[model samples]
Target: MTATILLTPAVEERAPCTLPPRLVLAPGETTPVLIDGAWWPRSRDLTAELPALIEILDPLWGRITRVTVNPTFWPVIPRKVPVRGHVVHVGWFEAEQDPHKLLLLSYTVGRWDLLVIPPETEPAIAARLMATATDPSRSLTATGLIHEAERFRITAEEAVGSDSLREAVWDSEGGNDARRPASHASAGAVIDHVPSPAEGR
Candidate 1:
């Protein structure tokens, strides 16, 4: 197994807001697959984004005691985040962690891996990705699924100017082609181990 460096920075605990996260899970029971679902967070702020996710997932999959993510996509990697009444430890592995995936550990459900879709992705593209990631027949890893999605993407021309101008142009281009964006596929790593309570905490 690849070694992971755990970081436990002292972070202030706050109440979970219980907001909904853009997530889609594979139908049926969990099975052996590279990715079990996909999550498209609104932003790269881990501290702000995680509580809502934890609130939605805990009751269904059991209390998530630990969450591991790659630091590449997230700007702020907190040591721990509060959800409900408990704390969830967060960790990161530079080398072996997939930048496009998030690994969650729950004592009841075991380990779960999810594809981390880019926040700026268009809604149409993101919806397709969510469907692909949760398809039980598709066993692609987070990276694999992204590459597959890129194959069908049609990049829209860049609108050079103010943000308002960009939005105006985006609104005017009302066609099927307008819904796509440039490919965001990138290289990522794989993680296979779930740390025991004694070692993870």
Candidate 2:
């Protein structure tokens, strides 16, 4: 009897990636902000955590694209921290019934910062919204959001804080800044929405 020769095909081993996967998610209200990787755990409860988030988040309620209270992962985001003061609130204000611009107001124990994001549709309106958010005389309730389908909506039960709360990230350092100021500024404006090269696999 002649025995046939058998050969086993070699399995190619995958190389370990040196760089971490870039975080990506289209801006919108949703669960588990990070798309391709692990950030928030599957075992945690969002309902039990909602109240504390609002208490800590205080006045930062608006069109929140993403939020997580007491997240359990090292977020891959470039953020200025409490050293400058954490971002306390983020949302987009309305402009002549259209989504205008993003108004982000950050605060600390004794400090506050106001940074504006464009496609500035109505610079005057954006300035007013910013003023409303930053005005020391205004109450948190007075700065409440307008309900629009195009914008992210936060119900009375869902307001929350931003530490470990990631609503947006960048493909590069200039992702938000590199775009032309004239680009349309919707509630969820993603000027840089392409997936990372690592995600191609």
> Residue by residue across 127-164, what tens digits does model 1's lDDT show?
99999998778877788888877765732222123334
Report the C-alpha lDDT of model 2 over 1-201, residue by residue, as the tens digit: 111221221111222222332111222333322121111112122222222332333444332223312122111211111111222221222332122112223233222222211222244443344444343343332114222211332321133322112234341333456673533334234434534435534
Task: Supply the global lDDT for candidate 1.
Answer: 0.75
Task: Give the RMSD in angstroms, all C-alphas superposed, for model 2.
Answer: 25.0
Winning candidate number (lDDT)? 1
Residue pairs that clash (backbone atoms under 3 angstroms), model 1: none
Q: Weakest 10 consecutive residues, lDDT, candidate 1?
A: 184-193
Backbone clashes counted, model 1: 0
> Which TM-score value belongs to model 2?
0.18
